[model samples]
Target: MIYFFKLIRWKNLLLIILAQLLIKYALLEPLKVDYGLDTALTPLGFILLVIATISIAAAGYIINDIEDVEADTINKPDSVIIGKQISEKSATNLFIILNIIGVVSGFLISRAVDKSAFFVLFIITSGLLYLYSTYLKRITLIGNIVIAGLVSLSILLVGIFDLIPVISDSNKSSQLFFLSLIKDYAIFAFMINLLRELVKDIEDTDGDYKMNIQSMPILLGRSRATKLVFILSLIPLMIIVFYLSNNLYKQPMAIGYVLILIVAPMIYSTIKLFNATHKKDYKHISTVLKLIMLTGVLSLLLFQFILLK
Candidate 1:
């Protein structure tokens, strides 16, 4: 059971659940009350949506682990689970089961909202995750970008389901306004996750090389890859500064929160990435990026402060 939880990356699945809950409750709920913004998901339906997203994500993790067993044995042999703790066959079965649950639940939620077309997103995401594990993981940069876009998509899914379905000609402008806010957060997720993915590539370069998997770190050398990632890391800082100047300048509390929690750590991470050499250093930077992603998501809670007042 413990190994199973680790295989599915329960902690990451929890983060996904938390982010979705925050989107519906902290962000959209406040706006709905203060601004009369319409939302589509009922509590029960929202639960289904979370289930669908995490199930697919869990499946993705499992399949990725299965495919990377050789790499894992080299990269972090002690942490490898697919062959020792969990059989490859069992892991494959679990992946299939999770994908079914995810896609079917997605179909149900899409139908519930009278948008059956939205069901395709789940199928496509599941397919992409599978392809990424098997084929795309071998490519340079493409795999990282694909995974990062999927991370952003998870956040944007909330806006597509909750905000878009309810948009009317009367409230189209206001609906789009809130959706744009969600989109901004999605973009933030993309940037942070992209950096993290690149950092992971650098960290796993030895293992990836053994498997003939090419990455930025492998192709350009770790020093060059780290330099590129360090440059990319600054993009989020610029976006946050622009966002603060244009949107949150008046809200001192909000600006302070972004600076202290999100922006400061990002700066620290970039500096660390610049100096990073050992695998442990890259791992630490990856962890910091994950925390920044969490803080960025949690920033949605501040919307209650900004919108209600």
Candidate 2:
């Protein structure tokens, strides 16, 4: 059981659950009455959505692990689970089972909202993750972008189901306004996850090279790739600054929260990235970036106070 949880990356799955919960309760629900908005999913339906999303995500992790078993053996042999704790056949079975649950649950929820078309999103996401693991991960940068985009989509999925389905003419603008808010956070998640993926690419260069994987670090060389990633890391800082100046400048509390929790840590990660040369250094930077992503999502809670004010 313990190994199964680790194989599915329960921690990351929990983060997905947390972000979706915040989107529903802390962000979207608060705006429903004031903006004359209606949500398509009830609380129970929303729980099903969370299950669908995380089930597919866990399946992704399992399949990725199965395909990367050789690379994992070279990279982190001690942490490898597919062959050590669970048989490859068992892992594959789990992958198929989870995907079935995810897509079926997605179908049920979409039909419940009378937007059966939304079911395609789950199928596409599942297929993309499978492609990413089997083939795309071998291509430089493509896999990183694909994974990052999916991370962003997880955040946007809530808005699509909850808000878009209920957009009447009277509430179209308000619906879009709140949907745009979710989109902004999704973009933030994209930028952070993209960088983190590249950092992991750098960290696992040795194993990737051994496996003939054409990752960014293997293609450009770790030093050059790290330099590129360091430059890219500046983007979120710039975006946050622009966001603050345009929107949050008047809200001192919001500004303080962004600076202290998100901005400061991002700067620290950037500086660390600049000097990061060893695998351990990249690992540390990756951990910092994960925290930044968490803080960025938690900022959604602040919207409750901001909206009320």
Q: Give the clash count for each candidate.
A: 0, 0
Question: Which ten residues in a row are the worst by lDDT in model 1?
Answer: 27-36
Clashing pairs in 1: none
- Please report the candidate that would top lDDT against the real structure: 2
List ranges where model 1 is wrong by over 4 Å: none
Instruction: Report the lDDT tens digits of candidate 2 across residue range 13-58.
Output: 8888889999999998887788787899998899889999999999
- The per-residue C-alpha lDDT of model 1 at residue 94 equals 98
Candidate 2's TM-score: 0.99
TM-score for all models, in order of appearance: 0.99, 0.99
The worst-scoring run of ten residues by lDDT in candidate 2 lies at 29-38
Residue 57, candidate 2: C-alpha displacement in angstroms: 0.3
Q: Whole-model lDDT, candidate 1?
A: 0.93
